[model samples]
Target: MTPTKTIVQISSILEKLFEEHFEKKVEEMEALAVSGSDRRYYRISGGGSVAIGTYNANVAENNTFFYITELFRKHKVNVPEVYKINKDRRAYLQQDLGKTSLFDLVIKDGFTDKNRKLYHAAMAQLAKAQWIAGREADFKQCFASKQFDEKAIMSDLLYFKYYFADLQNIQYDRSLLISEMELLSKDLGRVQPQTLMYRDFQSRNIMVYEGKIYFIDYQGFMQGPPQYDIASLLWQARAQLPAAWKEDLLNGYISTLNELHVPRMDEIYFRRGYVQFVLVRLLQVLGAYGFRGLLQHKAHFINSIGPALKNLEIFLADHPQTPAYPELRSLLEKMSAPDMQDKYATTRGSEQSKLTIQVSSFSYKNGIPKSAGQHGGGYVFDCRGILNPGRYATYKHLTGNDEMVRQFLERETRMPDFMNHANALVAINVEDYMARGFEHLDIAFGCTGGQHRSVYAANQMAEYLRSRYNLEVTVSHLNEKKWVLPDAAKTEE
Candidate 1:
């Protein structure tokens, strides 16, 4: 809905609500950023305080949020307190927990110690809400689905198949995949849900204000395992928590569950359920991205697909053989392959108005990544002669993207001399390519191990090209994902 129309509706609702609840009048209301859902949010100001106003044409969803909010607030869950609901239930005003989402903070400071503490605290709160408030959340008011059973799980899988998989032309036995999904659903379904499950409990859905975490977007709350929410939070596509961080947060959640005196969740069963849910959530997210990005042409959503797929790849690599569905597991591994990634690079390929200069870094040990297309080959510059940071014990785990490696390459080597000559040569070629109307160019940097010097070179080349020319640039550290040459498909939007 348009801002003007939404404000008008909010104003009307506020007027009625004031007569019933508060004496304060709203002085101002401005539209907040739109979320993935169809809800319209506004920051309403009044009586020296601010509240959030939510509007949605779908009254059922709004009602669900409202009723759930009431239930949660009654149980002291860290959710926005609802002040008023419109008679039609199309709009409501609730407490404003501030504009900062956990995602915003994470992007600003990464996974720092403070952020880790905050994540743990949020998980504790999540555990409490699920166990304490979840049981009492008026399931009758649950929107769309009341129970996350086999049917719900199948729906999520089918969403991925139709929306995401169909776009890639992946060859797989549909019946076999479905049967596997059914089996997987049964495995997770046995978890015995005891609390309310927040269907979309990611970092973005949790607001961090005044050193406290508050929840939002619980309209899809229903009876489900707490592991699903944990998967959603830790395996969030954009947040990109490292494997270590995810494990730490998982342990924190489990500890909180134990403290809450919740049922003794068998660690073995919970871990298995968590991994399955991680896969399931990845599929659900890919479907959403495919619909919002590929079909609707939203660049951000399109950009997110790469990260989401990476999260999936990480999970698959960590567990190579899916004992349950070998065929499905192989299909997922194929989907994570560079060749498969190329098939799904529609967001950039479809927008062919500008030339895309692909700058990639690889380790010679694993071989160089293929050029983006069959447009012949491109330059492959060897950085093996340069001093290797991988030789150092401290920098072993660090990649070129890390500040330490970047600084090491600049301070401890003849990188400046190499880059100067490399830049001049590439500039000459780029100028010629631009004049000739060539659409693609690839510049690869390969070292003994792609982790260090090559990564540094690729990063520098991408930066230099972006600064010197008005060309579209894509920088991919092919070896960043453990020597696996992921697609050099990250393009500047």
Candidate 2:
């Protein structure tokens, strides 16, 4: 949605929330700068008080955040206080942590002793979140996957290979690369004495509120080796912390972990796992830069590719080649070469992108949408398991595009979890098709009436793919109209 449309919808909800929950009118709502995801955030103030209001369509992620906030506050983890969640679980109000992010501090102060102390404090608190709070929290409330299992690990690796490496022609021997990825995932999964992994831990996610260190953006947390979190924080590319500082902070983290009185790890074994996580984490970030910078044409992310590549180069120099991932090391070695920077620096290969995806929604009662392309490739997702919004008289004439049906399906049904899993399965094929240079792929969603669930799924998936990859995408609701293929050999529009 455009910013204007988004504001219209969000203003309505925020107005109601302020009036009903806080018994005050919203005097002002200022848009805040956000990094990733489609979540909309506003600084809301009224009656000489201020709070942050958030609106997101991803219900599963919202629920995960709400649940984790409650758990973290109960254990003294120093997260923002969640004041209220609106009905439908998509909008909420939380305590505002006063606008000073650790990133802003580093930028303004420029890496001084005081900032270093804040870093140390943040690390110590991370230990508590992992060891004490997250140790017993209900993983069942977690969104998407509960653990960073082999499947999750491999997904990260593939994300790098396809989005970053394949775009740069770095992953040369697809079969061998797959073998190395599987082995690395197995080794990571077997690491013992696991705890919560803050999957996106970084300085930007840390808030400095009233001389205290507070962590945010952790709804992506999962059960995994604790080392991943530290590796993620210390080796973040944009921070560009000095090598000596990184080494010192790493050792400091280990000491803090030991003080927790958990089972002690052999320093050697722990360091090995840390190294693996560091390598994978760097690649994962490069993949993000590729999508946001190269495909999406964002200069801020595009400029960071140089620094991120430098970080990878530094990591490789510190840790020499290992036999466990010869292919991966070779690929990274080539990518890190100072001379090859031109390929990924200013331009993306979007002009050469070959894949086009057709997404459609249909009612099973009418018939499945038939594929007309010569490639003859596609998959159908059955969304009938989702509750039918059509069953209610208010939603009978409304389609998924209508706010009422969208709210009903998202708020009242298990559509979030169902689509989460379905997207995971479809993403595998989509990436593979892109890597293989296929010209066309088809995806369709079906439900009993196709007016609500199927249409919602199809629209959401189309939006996701368009943002994720540099591919031509089109969508049509087959149940609502006749979409005749132009020819047997083609399927455009």
Candidate 3:
């Protein structure tokens, strides 16, 4: 469900829970929907002046909410004071910060340039919260139940598969695509992980009560990459900021971070953070567009496709060196062209042309694979596989450990040969194994069921290949049937 509707549903549940908990009739209940990974909200005027309700509650999210709210309060960051929390019930009571969200302020009448200053001030408060939280934050224990580690990140990468392959019923080489993505994550890990990130720190989540920015909807805080919250604000899909204004806002954020005495804060970090933010937004937009448009029959997200792509295009153009640039560029180019629908159809080819690879008997102990399994006899094709070798290679190089991969792709180095191979082998090989040369390859891992083992192998191989060879790759799970590479017929001969 859309977050808004989910919040409303949760509010109804909370009303019932409060009535049962207090053994009193709910005289009046108003549900104020909030945003984030899961639907959350506040229910007002039911038997008390205030009550908070969260739909998806677990130990990690509950703790995160408590931790972030306490940290923000201690750091003098403006946020509502929690009264009582029924952690087990996913319900809480807190001070009412009035009903004036920054969303209303920005979109409402009389919102002036002065309001931008207020927004920036609110962001500054957020910066202060992050600075202080960064010091005492125990990332390992903070959101332990939520699994916000490498494994969780990998699961997020699978959303594309869920929406594109499973829901949309598109087909592509599952093993190869996944192998490509796993490699990307390792490079992503190189980014310094710090701070308790408020996964959705947008204007809507900030309240303008009592002339201060009061933080809310903060249940999903995590010890994660710092750029997440920063990116959430700057690249907010609903409130699209102009380029110049985004720059000003970013500068304001940096100045606030500096004033808060955050260590090693600079434009470089800001730029890096901004790139991460853009990448996240791109993923979210793609997922939302695909799900809403294709699955839910909601066309509004479809309309957003053009603008979202444009925003990503601008970001990718600015940061040509970002690991996500190649994928972002390919998606943007596909979406923006006048013949996008035609080109997309021609590129995906027919379902019969697709292949699925599975991995058999693979295990990982502390991020290193223990067993290198066979390809398990999946269909093999001679035709060039989907995705140009250059683009795949570029992504692989950007996401690899070797600094030279980054340098070559971002700077003056010539493109490598792996960019030319569409039928490359994609699987976990024993160290120094000589089954096939690692030069030009796109391998996929598949199992009999095409679900668990194949998926796991695809992920492991993708990570290994990206980290080892820095090659552009893609991964797919054949059973889900999501992605489709461009057809050779449409390519330039």
> Which one wins on lDDT?
2
The candidate, 2 or 3, that scores higher on TM-score is 2
Per residue, candidate 1 scores C-alpha lDDT tens digits across 285-367 of 99998876655444467667777888888888887654358767877887888765554443433343356799988888888
- Which stretch of 10 consecutive residues in model 3 shows the poorest summed lDDT? 361-370
Per-candidate RMSD vs. true structure?
A: 17.2, 12.1, 20.1
My TM-score estimates for the predictions, one after another, are 0.68, 0.68, 0.57
lDDT by residue (144-259, candidate 2, tens digit) is 78898878888988988878788775547889988999898887778866787778889999999999999888998888888888888888887888877788888888888789
The lDDT of model 2 is 0.79
How does residue 296 of candidate 1 score in lDDT?
47
Task: Look at candidate 1 and tell me the lDDT of residue 130.
Answer: 90
Predicted candidate 3 versus true structure: per-residue lDDT over 387-452, tens digit per residue = 222243222212222232222221222221222121133323321232333223334433333323
**What ranges in model 2 sit over 4 Å off?**
1-6, 342-493
Per-residue error for 441 in candidate 1, Å, reads: 17
